[model samples]
Target: MGSAWTQSFREELSVGKVKFSLSQPELLLQPQWSISPLAWLLYRLFMLLYTFIWCLYSALLFSSPKWLLFLSHIVYCSMAMYYLLALCNLVWAAIQVRNFYRNAAANQNEGSRVRGGSVGPFPLPPLLSAALRLQWCLHNLVSSFSVTVTLLYWMLVYPIEKHPLSTFNINMHVGNSVQALLDLVLSSTPIHLAHYVHLFLAACLYILFLLLYWLSGGTSLSRKPYIYKVLDFGRWPLVAAFSVIGFICIGLPLGHFLLLVPLKV
Candidate 1:
């Protein structure tokens, strides 16, 4: 019966694909919060605004050569991107809260008194409350720290060069008498190091995120399901994706100018 029920629920979720959890905490809050559609829509609206701003920043840099070298402009754009990500997460958090409210309403309608108006049934499981609080703290701290550091790094490292791509000495093996290829990484770079740090922190955030989702659902971490195990392993692909993009975002523009550029492969 649970299999049939889970299957039906999964099918409905798949049809929309836009809403609900593929894994943990997202589903946790929905059943618990009873979030209203209006509340959810409001959060989505924030995301829309957030995306528009990102596009605006990109266009500004691509079109206006004047802003490219200005440290202040670069800082502003970086900060804007950070804020956008933060806004998205804030919306996610709201969705979770709403789900809590929805679930509370459901539980109350059944006369269970489970969570009066989203407080989560009295005497609320003390451990559950503690766990949820911990999860929230971890997620927010990671989010804020990552965004803050990223903005600071870009601001401090804005390039002075007009067209930075001219400097890298390129080597190619078209006629291969020798098969060896030279892979060079620049030795002195704060920007490259800062991005590495960001990658590490982001990984921490993803793991913390999964833990939080489990806590929100009142599920014990000890009993992590096969699905979550799959999510945990997903970190590798995420890291790979981020690595390429990070190099492009941080290293590519600078690498073009730097005397000694690193080979990402």
Candidate 2:
């Protein structure tokens, strides 16, 4: 019976014929405080605007004429992409909430709860719903990345005390890291182990990009093919292996901790 049900579900999903329904509005998954659809839409838009501004500011700081310069480094690319995905997810969520309410209003008998698989918010089609669920997961990983970057640069790579003359750099570093960490703390999204794949793939892609840049003869101000000294290709196999392991150690624990955050009822 389980196998038959699973097969039917898969077939329904393949044809986009599946519909999901939930009995209660409060049962919906949300990160942080739930607000009106308009408020949610505005919140996402505000974040999108901030992300755009930050990218421009970062570009100016680098003062590089080539657009590829930003793409070459994982920091800007990954972080920016994260914000973009968040913005998209917010839009989808807003739509879902709007649809939910509209359906509820139409069906005066249903109270505040969602019903039927017809066209309500709650149980979205499996694929799109799954994608929506990923938003917070990616957010957590990106937040982890932000924290990791700050710690790695400030504590392990170069302490602010050593670079006292570069106070502006310190401000940027602290601002970015603090904001990311705060966002994670404020969110109400639940973490899932399956979503760890997204984090892993993100890291792998960045490493691949760096290697490709090196192979293509990209160089920094110091004429090294790699942007960070820790990634210096000259050190080869050992450096590469250690860097990967080190990131996993930092990321996995951080992700697990986010999952462990106590949820407010």
Candidate 3:
């Protein structure tokens, strides 16, 4: 008992009271979120929060310096508003799909051994399977191409020299009717218009994912295995994420939102 007590205290792993405090944060570790749809939803939520906080932090950082803060807000507000609008719209769609599935499962599972397997196998004919796969492949390819081009513009082109607004493929067609109106009203600059347009295209892919998710009615058999399904949902987001990583690799010449105009000396 004496040696046990000595060894426990001597080891770095044991500190008794401090262990509880140290491990408190780990209690929030989310195993349920290991699955894809859940994970993607969490990720989307976090990114939305992250952008919001990042903008807020930037705003507060320059609070004492009014001119600089206003300048900072100009960039932050322009970018953040679009992000917030898109994020909320996507979240609402996801919730609609989720609730539709939940109510659906409740209806069809009166006394079955299974939960929601009544969705049964898809009636996809051989032709349709091939066609769906082809469509998926094309969707992924175009999505990848868009990611690549945008990253190239942000990293290589913008870093060295400013390009004309005509360079980027900026078409602003996002959201439902009401949200689209907000996007149209808010988006004025060519650069911001370009960003918002790409987001709109990305939103379409997400909507397609949501459509597939609910079309199959969000059941286990109605879905792919959880891992595959999550990967499927994350496909386009992954492209965008990695492309952003490439942009981060280039990073900024100095700090965040530093130079919009080319310096002349």
lDDT of 1 by residue, 209-263 (tens): 5445544652222443311222332345564445434544554334222311222
Error of 2 at 50 (Å): 2.3
Please write out the lDDT profile of model 3 over residues 128-219, one tens digit for every residue: 33433332222222323333334344555455445345411132111111222232223221111112233335445544554465456443
| Candidate with better TM-score, 1 vs 2 | 2
As for candidate 2, its clashing pairs are 31-188, 32-188
Task: In candidate 3, list every pair of residues with a backbone clash.
Answer: none
Predicted structure with the largest lDDT when compared to the true one: 2
Model 2, residue 146: C-alpha shift (Å): 1.2
TM-score of each: 0.25, 0.64, 0.27
Query: Against the correct fold, how does model 2 do in TM-score?
Result: 0.64
Clash count list over all predictions: 16, 2, 0
lDDT of 2 by residue, 50-142 (tens): 656766765676677443442223444455666676666666655776787676667756643434535433555555566544555456566
Off by over 4 Å in 2: 1-31, 34-42, 65-77, 99-131, 159-168, 193-195, 235-241, 250-265
Candidates by TM-score, descending order: 2, 3, 1
